[model samples]
Target: MSSISMRKTTLAAAGLAVAGTLVLTGCKDGNEEVPAAPAAPSSAASAPADGYATPPAGGASSAAPGASAGGYDGASGAPAAGGGAVATSGQSFKIGQAATIPFTSGSKSGQLALTVTSIEAGNPADLASLNVADKVKGQTPFYIHYTAKNTGTTDLSFASVGHIKGLLDGGAESGVLLIAGKFDKCPNESLPSGFTTGKTQASCAVALAPTGAKVTGAEYWGDPYNNLNKPAQKGLTWK
Candidate 1:
């Protein structure tokens, strides 16, 4: 299979298990700390083929469009009506707010108005459809429902807008759970063909909170925001 196809297959079949502890730094809120624990091990069992990969720790492989310009609500840190203004790096927002942010996938670059609509608790029993191992299945699952729109001039078809991660209470990052095939509970998909200006798509990301913990927020660390050396800000957060 081609690299793109392989990546899609990998995303669909199973979740990516990080091999070690991850220490986050430079969080403006001073709450972006992850507890020291061994990373979840990858499951040996295979899933039925057919899904997209989780957004990589480095970045995502696809891009989406953005929302129109407007005003910023200082109190809630969200964009006002008409989609508001393009968000700067490191900005914070509330649930249901929209952030018009920039992103790049390969040679494609564009603006995407991403709205993290809600973070809902999911029943662990629903995970039976996935190929997750029992070792990690005990972790609580949270579904991050979001919408992405192309607000730029580029055609970002097949590009994914999936850099959002789940945050536990006290701001620890949650483990990502990948699904191999179609997940009816929280379906995730890539931008379809002809995803030009004004095009929009809705998707979901699965975040697994450690047993006994609760998910309270999410963070977006796409593109220049993830760059450590540059002066650009680090990431955007939402609660």
Candidate 2:
């Protein structure tokens, strides 16, 4: 099968497993990169409080279109074993537990707060609901849901949905399934359109894993400052 067809099949399986049905929605087509503040010519302006140079306004993610449902190129199957958690200051959370990470500085500058409300293992029955052009074997779906709000007085760009990642035990990274407006089982209030000050929307992403994959936990990196090799923010442990 073709790569796009394979991705759509995997997405269909994941969507049904998580949402009770398939409702694909969101800005996967647009090349609109995450926004960053303009650079300054003077030496004093050269440095931003965050230390890293802002991504250019039109800069696209390194991943190509349909590269993988959630920007990964690897296919769904068993991954290499023996992975550990990424080191991070993120607090531990339980399923349905809510955690907030407030933006203290940078382009966001107190204007944004990311709230992760829940995490859960997906239902296998939902997988049966899918009508696939092809079948992806041994994979199951997991979900991470959250809300991003703009607390500032002015309108700022809100695109935190694409940045989050998921992993299984042994540090196997899951493929992110982009959800548009139709997340049936995993209802997120915000998505497609983003947040303005006092505006909040719920959104969720489905991560595909092999059946019987031991998913002991999940992680979220709201800030890019997190170490790529470890969990840099918050996580959940299934009790």
Candidate 3:
């Protein structure tokens, strides 16, 4: 209750208030400004996670090559050059006769010749074990063996032989199947899957229907790429 004691107490209380104000000001400064996190790159953020664009319509995409829109070669059956015409001519032959046929049109320009050296009925036991077995059930399989030589500037594809056919004794025409070796000493040379120009005669085979059903006539369906429109190579008689 003394005057001196009262003055000292009041001074102490004022100093404490000032100190509290300073502490609060320091805290406000600390909270006043905070650095922001860096923003993500816009391009990467907007891009797809996998980094692939949607495929184009018509089955065409930059990601894929050589896929046909319709899943097939166009009806023209011709492919533009690399070189050559839009189509070509095909040839005919007797059972044992060999002839040099010129392909005048289409993407391939060449002298491709074929000789059907022998024809034989496929053995059922052996054929049933082959890839063609499932394809030729009910119909007998015939092995059509031939020699093919390519002597032109462009390559010729013997893979088209699947289109060749035979007329049966009953007048039914059957498409040739996969080439297979039916026996030893078949005299058929293993032909190239495709013939580059200047290649020598190569052996090839095709399977036809109705085993032991005589193949009275042989026919070629022609290579559409070569633009061949020849009539079926007919009058082919085999024993």
Cα RMSD for candidates in order: 12.9, 18.5, 32.6
Q: Estimate, for each residue in 1-239, the C-alpha lDDT of model 1 and write its tens digit.
A: 89999999887655433212122221211112111123243232222222222222422111222321221223122442335666655566787887777667657887788888999998777775453445345677789888988887889987756567877887667766544336777766567789898988998877888778887777787665665565434466677
lDDT of 3 by residue, 1-239 (tens): 79999999999999999899644432210111111123332221111111101111111011112222222123222443222222222222346754444443334445555556666665555444344444455666556666655645676643332223455675465444432223332222223445676566644444455655766554443333223132321222222
RMSD in angstroms, candidate 3?
A: 32.6
Off by over 4 Å in 2: 1-110, 124-135, 156-160, 187-194, 221-223, 226-239
Better of 1 and 3 by TM-score: 1
Candidate 1 vs 3: which has more lDDT? 1
User: TM-score, each model?
Assistant: 0.65, 0.44, 0.43
CA-lDDT, candidates in order: 0.61, 0.41, 0.40
Which is the leading candidate under lDDT?
1
Best by TM-score: 1
Give the C-alpha miss distance for residue 73 in model 3, angstroms. 22
- In model 2, what is the error at residue 59, expressed in angstroms? 24
